[model samples]
Target chain A: MRTKTLITSMGLFAMLCVVIFGLGVKGLALDETFRRFVLAALWVCTWFAAVVGLNRAAASDRNKSFFSALMLLPFDPALVYLVRLVSTLVWLVITQALLVLLAVPMLKFDFFSQPLMLAVALMADVGILALGVLLASATGRLRGGEALLTIALLPVTVPVFLAATGATEALHTGSGAAEAWPYVLLLGVCDAMFLALGLLLFGKLNEG
Target chain B: MKAKTSNAPLITLALAALGLIGAEVTLYLSYFYTPVQISAGTLYVVTPSSGSTINLYESYRIFFIHLPAAYATALCCTLAAVGGIAWLLTRKDAWQALIVSASEVGLATGAIVLLTGTFWADYAWGSGRIGSGWNWEPRLTTMLILWLAFAALLVLRRAMDTDKQRAMMTAVYGILLGPLYPLVSKAIEIGQTSHPKSFSDLLSAPEIATTKQVATIGILLALVSMVALRYCWNRLGQRMAQERAA
Candidate 1:
């Protein structure tokens, strides 16, 4: 049953991603305003996915043993969080790649051609996903957790969003990548801060 | 058995009254005594210019109130973060109350900052060059973030079923975002937006620095006194609720 649920959810999530990204590309191709709108949409959806996924795992009887076994391990609890973070990043990267692929044909922007752009997108996704999971886990069991998480996530994500958007726009315009580098660096710093805090705090939150 | 009531609320009220009086005095000094300084053009020009280019904007009187409100908001958030850290380390009820009180006040003051900021932005940058009042300038953007974060913190605390869970989560969230304050300021400095480089820029001349300094100190005291009053009120409310349940 757990395996079935997991597979079904994964399939549904992928289909949803395809539809959203496809429509986004078809409608808003090559428009700077639309690009920003897309970025905002991506952050919201990614955050929702992280929270929903974590809540489901916590709810599942099957995952209980998995979490417990990891908790009882000789290693530090941060390792468990680190593993979860990595797995989430992997899933996020796959969805991002799909979106990029869908946009490439309609928008004529190739993620493969520009490795720096690709790196920025991937890094930004990891940072966002990490922060999302940490916040989701912190608030997931409570009443109105989802709403609270959304509100809390917005303010924290502002710097990351601005930096990521600025860098991507610079790359797309093929102008002033030098100017964009600072934003990219800022993005990296934000990501590191999120990842480090997530590692340190996830265990403490889980304990209670 | 007879119950004894604590005098904290009365003391807090007195402090709050003093703060209100101080704020009014500061406003009077700023408006009546000080000469208003304004940047010639744009809402948030960060560059330093020679004294000749300085323009007098009577509307610039808003700076006195705006700066104090901004400072109060920032200080309250800092207090929240500190209270959160203390709670995490000790798991005490006092720390929880401290955070809750500070956050509530922080949210109110943060709104003041945003509201007054909009007026100042309009006066400085809204007309002439941009025609629009809003800019994604770093300081304004950061304050918006801070306000939202404070609101979220309050929501998160209320959403929890248990006090312990609420306290723990609040502490973590507070500490996690504490770094954001400094990051925002650094981003503004590096990005260089329309905001003036220093509060000193708002002063008319070097001689009036004494007035600015005293007014600032007065406002800071008033803001802190208000936070203390809020903390006392929160504790009083909690006690009343507990007694009713009993």
Candidate 2:
């Protein structure tokens, strides 16, 4: 029940963000200025919604003593970090899918038509959440943790996000896979780094 | 364990002195040794009375301060990340102190990198507009992000309550910063169409290259001294925290 609420709220929040962003660029045609700006705008709003969702989810876990329950378990805490990342990934996947579904028409971009860009977006999510899970846990237990998590997470992920948007743009324009593959590879490198750090350091997030 | 020597202050003082000397030599060489080839500086009239034949590359002199700060920024970040990883493994207070001190120094040097970079950008790429010292170039953007992350780490490091929490949080933040520099470095190999590359061509001159090497060494020494001094200060705080806990 709790997880359902989080998924719904996060999905709704993402929709709200996409709608606001759409309003900011209202009346821009599909193949004109809209195409140029839509890719970056969509990714930014998605990441924004993702960051907020992660912060809220982590906060609730701590508040309800779910974190304490996990800490008391016999298994390694790093496993908890991985499990939470997977669970967060699942909820975010649902919410973000809804967000993108809405994004397709309002933004006038055939997001579903491009399999490559969708792959890029999914890869981008791994890097974001991998670092996001660790930073969220580290900051969520503090005062003003929500704001700090967003502030801290965004800058660290800028390079990957930049590459994600660039790759998405390249693929959307009918560019060949060869041209866009480098950006995808960069995303992979960052994702690996983030995941490795999460697995290595998640156990140290909050002491036992 | 043996009693530690009281030479820390003297050692720090010597490093600071060496850094100062390096700065002095670098500046002196930049002005007097390097030949002027660009039409980018105050044009010296070649009157028979004046010994001036070539124009000085005044803006190029920023490389001395700029390159050193860039090197120091990278050094401090690497130190912080290494210290953070070591702390996580060993759980030692000195390692914790090392990350904190390195982070503070890195933040200072990162700001210098941005400020100095803007100066270079304006001179090299600006269209003679006021407040046009910066653009959204890829490498510049990467540097800015790295600087902002440094600031965020220090800020978040303060919000933790206990010693263990602070150390752990800071270690994670520092380690989080680890992959970013390399990623950006790699990313710049593509899509960096606008960064000024003429400066590199000019650096083939033996004088400028040697001067940069000297300046980098000197500035790194000063920055490292700062980290060491800060580490000592952080160790003092750690002792107080332990004493209070006892």
Q: Candidate 2 residues A1-208, lDDT tens each?
A: 9668766786677679678888888866666457767777778777876787687778788789788787788878788889989877876677778877877777776777777877788888888998889888878777888888888898888867877877886777777677789889988987888888888888778666
* lDDT of each candidate versus the true structure: 0.69, 0.76
Off by over 4 Å in 2: A1-8, A27-31, B1-5, B39-57, B128-131, B196-200, B244-246
Candidate 2 lDDT score at position A138: 74
Best by lDDT: 2
Q: Where does model 1 exceed 4 Å of error?
A: A1-75, B1-5, B36-56, B128-131, B204-208, B237-246
Model 2 CA lDDT for position A83: 91
List the TM-score for candidate 1's chain B.
Answer: 0.84
